[model samples]
Target: MRVLLVGAGGVGTAVTRIAARRSFLTHMVVADYDLARAEAAVAALGEQGTRFSARRLDASDQDAVRTALVDERCDVLLNATDPRFVMPLFEAALAAGTHYMDMAMSLSAPHATAPYEECGVKLGDEQFAQAAAWEASDRMALVGMGVEPGLSDVFARYAAEELFDEIEEIGVRDGANLTVEGYDFAPSFSIWTTIEECLNPPVVYEKDRGWFTTAPFSEPEVFEFPEGIGPVECVNVEHEEVLLIPRWVDARRVTFKYGLGDDFIAKLKTLHELGLDATAKVAVPGPDGPVQVSPRDVVAACLPDPATLGDRMTGKTCAGTWVKGTKDGSAREVYLYHVVDNEWSMREYGSQAVVWQTALNPVIALELMATGAWKGSGVLGPEALPPRPFLDLLGAYDSPWGLREER
Candidate 1:
């Protein structure tokens, strides 16, 4: 299948590496605003990049993106950009009549008055609003296809189908023991995304109460992660799985928590307090004159790119779903997880653990879509597809998942 990948950052770059090894991909056009970045990603593939090419494109330009989709005759528009560019790429795919997929969903806003108690525009609300449009076109828009929301969501459906007859709670728990050398405050993923999700009021779901907002980092608890990354304190973070899972999987309650340590939390709070996390553009003095720039963008510019930190990174990162329920009149509790060690990932794929893990799922999804193993129209999550085939494919990629009994 011919693909148009819209980002050439770390995750997007790792995607090209993984896709290059697969025979199912015919051609993948890696596009970015910085043409050099896209070219570099493709060039890194060396002899294996015969089927890959690079292009210069802006994700926010819907008409231009649509034109590019049509010009390149791409069957899918794979978005690897930030959440801020979700809608434009989504709409572009709709206009181009191509299947669409994204690692992250659209941005959400807090409730005007009851910011901590009520959700204003929840995650993926904007994409779900256009579900009918996609269905009418017989095209699919799969949002939240990254590791946490993607593989974690798949694990939720798998447990519901194969492990439990009745599920009480499905909580997505994410943690990492990875550390980067020479940097005291470096994130393993996108800092823009990390700030956005952590600062916003987190959302939780209940069968009776529906969805409600809570204070950021609320209801903290320590979760013991498998695969050598032991116990870490986790807290609620506004994540897409909390919004995506309940629609397809049967569960009384749903949540998503991240194991962001105390130092990371404190730094994030300080950014919020100083308004450095704001995405809105403000005037700043430049070499030419006063320039309009986003504070968050400036903050991102100040940090080392996460994609480049693999060589210095150590330890592992885990993404999993913790379920509690009853199966055949017996109580059941399990955590289905996928872990990636930085040293292994860097040696094998020349990419970091967190980014490589996130990149792996979408390529698998794309291959499945090409092979007809997974098929759907309209906006959907990973849970909406057949979980067995996806989990099986993970092993084929040499990144097998695991399950641990909690009780």
Candidate 2:
């Protein structure tokens, strides 16, 4: 199948490599706002059967995206771009009659200034409207197709489907410790997108109802992993799984949590207190004109690029879901997870574990769509699929799902 990938960042590059290795793609085109980045990614792939091409694309430009889809004859459109552009890319893909896939939910632009509550309220109806329209269309669109939002959601569903009779509580944990020699700090994914999630108010699912807001990092807890990786501290972060599991299955309470090393959490707390993670803009004097900047933009510009830290990264990331419920009138717990080492990921794909996990789903989803295993006409997510199909496919790639009963 012909695939047109939007965005050439770390995750995008990882997806491209996997796609080529699978040999499922006949023609592969990588486009980005930065043409040079796209070219670099294409050059690095070095695949024989898949014809690789690079181009410049502004995802917000609907006409340009539509033209590219027609010109490239793209059967599927993979959106690995900024979360802010997800909706626009989806719209373009629908218009062009191509399947769509994305790693995260659509988010607002400009950071560390506007209140997240305000942004969330403003986006509610409009977001649902877009989903409704996509569902009514003939094409398939998958959102939140990354590791945490994507695989984690599937893991939870698997538990609800096969392991538990009545799921009471579900928690998704993402823990990683990535240390690069030179860089003081770096995010696992895009800095701007990370900041958006870190600073936004978390929305957790409530029983027999809808979502309720929680302060970011408000509920901190410690979790113990089986082995290799030790117990790590986690805090609640707004993740899509928290919102999706309730809709897909019968769960009483659902929440998404993330764990960073103590050092990272300390720095994030300091940034939050200083109001540097806001998305709203403030004015400053400039030589050319009045300057407006968001604190997140400044921080993102100052931090070392996450993509550059791959060479020095050494560690492992253990992420998955924990489900608690009852079976035959007795309480039971089951955990489904995967552990990925940064060094190993670097050796195989020149990417960190975080990026590797985030990028793998879209390629697998594409293949499934092509074979008609995951094919459907509507906007959906990875959790919307049967757990076995997705789990079996991911297991083939060495990312297997493990289930253990808790005492």
Candidate 3:
């Protein structure tokens, strides 16, 4: 099938590599705001005798995205853009009458800081309505199709479906040591998105009530993962799973934790206390006029590019979900997780684990939709899809989903 992939960033690059390797894509068109980056990715793909081209397009511009879709005549549109531009890309897909899949739910703005309640109102229902229309046309659209909200959500579904009669708590943990011996600072994914997550108050679900927690790296704990990855310190952080999973499954509590090194945590804590994580603008003197700059923007500028860390990056990232509750009148706990090696990922895809995992899921979801394995209407997360297909796909790539029974 012909597929059009937007955004040539780290995740997009990794996704392209995985898609190319699977031969799922007969013809591929990669687009990015930065033409050079898009061209670089296309050249890197080096699919011998395969149809591939790179284009420069601003995905935020509906007309531009529509034109590219129509020109390419793509059967599927894989959106790998920033979350802020997801809705518009979805609209473009609908206008182009193609199957749609994205890595995250549509966000109103990149730096929006309001609580979920307020943010939900602003997001409105247009996107869902569009998705329903696509479903009526027999075209499928899957939202929040990344590793955390994507696979972690699927893991939760697998447990609820087969492992437990009822699930009480779902804890999604993502831990990665992106730091090597030389690099001082590096984030796993997009620096801008990472900073936004770090600055915002973590929204979590407990007993069906939504609540907020402190900033990133605020609440710290040591979590012992399965064999190989070992014990790593994690902190309660905001993730799409914490926001979307509770709505799909009946659960007492749902939370997401991210593992960060001690030094990274200290830097975040210092920034939080100093109010440097704020999204609100502060006056700054300029040459000709007074400029308003948000702390998030400034900090994002100061951070190292996550894409560059793939080469120097060492260590593995352990990401998975934990479900604790009772089944058959007995207490039970199940952990489903994956461990990705950074160096290995670079050798394979020229990217890191975080990017590889995030990028791989959308392609899998698209294949399912194309093959009638996952076809549905309305807004849905990874948990809404059957986990077996996804689990099998992960296994094919050696990123198998593991299950452990705890008494």
Candidate 4:
């Protein structure tokens, strides 16, 4: 299978390394808006003797994406790009008759200055609308396939099928307890995406009340993680898992939280208060005169490149789903979790735990698709398919999930 990956950032780099090692992939194309980043990613791959080619791609342009898919004869289009570029890439993949996979849902409008509200907007809702279209064409697209949305959703499904007679709640929690030595502030993932998810109004769902909104960082609680990670404070945040899981599981409650530290929350609040999260073009006086740029872009550019933080990062990422329900008429709960060590991941995969966990799982999903171990047609999230086939393959990648039944 030929794969065309459409981003060369940290996640893209991790995915490329995994894909290059996959025996099924005949050739891989690493495309990015910046040719240098693409070349850099491929160069690192070359050092590892992983065969890959690089290309300059304007991911925002639909025509360019379609052209690249056709020219490369790509069987799978892995979108490691930001959510802003997701829709066009998916559309292009559909046009070129290629399977599509991405880490998050597309922004409803790429030009929106603020995140969409919960009343009517949702992650992957736009793609879900095209489910019939994809099914008709015998194509498939997986959205929000990263660690939290992807793995957490798979955990929820596994619990529903294996552990619980009736699932009451699916709580997805992500805690990245890693420290990058040189920086007081650095996002483990994309700066733009972190800001969007953190600053936006949080959404949570209850079976009795339906979808509702909360202030960013509401409903704070401390939970103990397994195997020495200890207790970390988590808060309700807007994430795709809440939206996607509800489509498959009829849970009474669905929510997501991230263990973003208080200091980081304060910094994000400052950025929000200063209007630095907006995507609107603003003219600021530059050394050469007036320069037009987006504030969020400026903020992201001024930060250290996320791709270089792997070696300096140390700690573990313990993210999982906490499911509460009854099994065989008795109350039971289980924590389906996966933990990754930052230093170990960096040593093994040249990526931090956060990026390594998020980027590598999609390849497992791809393997299932390639081997026909899993079959589906249409736009689907992780829960829309069988969990064991994907979860069973995790141990091979040095990332295995655990299940802890709590008293």
Q: All candidates' TM-scores? A: 0.99, 0.92, 0.88, 0.95
Cα-lDDT of candidate 4: 0.86
lDDT of 1 by residue, 1-407 (tens): 98999999999999999999999999999999999999999999999999999999999999999999999999999999999899999999999999999999998999999999999999899999999999999999988998988999999999999999999999999999999999999899999999999999999999999999999999999999998899999999999999999999999999999999899999999999999999999999989999999999999999999999999999999999999999999999999999999999999999999999999999999999999998989999999999999999999999999999999
lDDT per residue, candidate 3, 1-407, as tens digits?
Answer: 88889999888888778877775568879899999998898888775325678999998899889889999989878888877788789988888878777876654332255453333321213565565577666666777788877888888888888888878899998776556557566676776676556555565678745644544455677877775677788877667787667767778888888776677767877887888877689999999988999887788778766777777777787778989988898889988887788877888778877788788788788777767788676566777878888788887776676776655
lDDT of 2 by residue, 117-140 (tens): 322442222344576666677677
The TM-score obtained by model 3 is 0.88
Q: Put the candidates in lDDT order, highest first.
A: 1, 4, 2, 3
Query: How far is 399's C-alpha from truth in model 1 (Å)?
Result: 0.5
- Candidate 3: regions farther than 4 A off: 108-138, 207-219, 272-298
Candidate maximizing lDDT: 1
Q: Best to worst by TM-score, what's the order?
A: 1, 4, 2, 3
Candidate number achieving the greatest TM-score relative to the actual structure: 1
- Residue 3 CA displacement from its true place in model 2, Å: 1.5
Error of 4 at 14 (Å): 0.7
What TM-score would you give candidate 4 relative to the actual structure?
Answer: 0.95
Give RMSD to native, each candidate.
0.7, 2.9, 3.3, 2.3
- Which has the higher lDDT value, candidate number 1 or candidate number 2? 1
Q: Which ten residues in a row have the lowest lDDT in candidate 3?
A: 116-125
Candidate 2, residue 397: CA error in Å?
Answer: 1.6
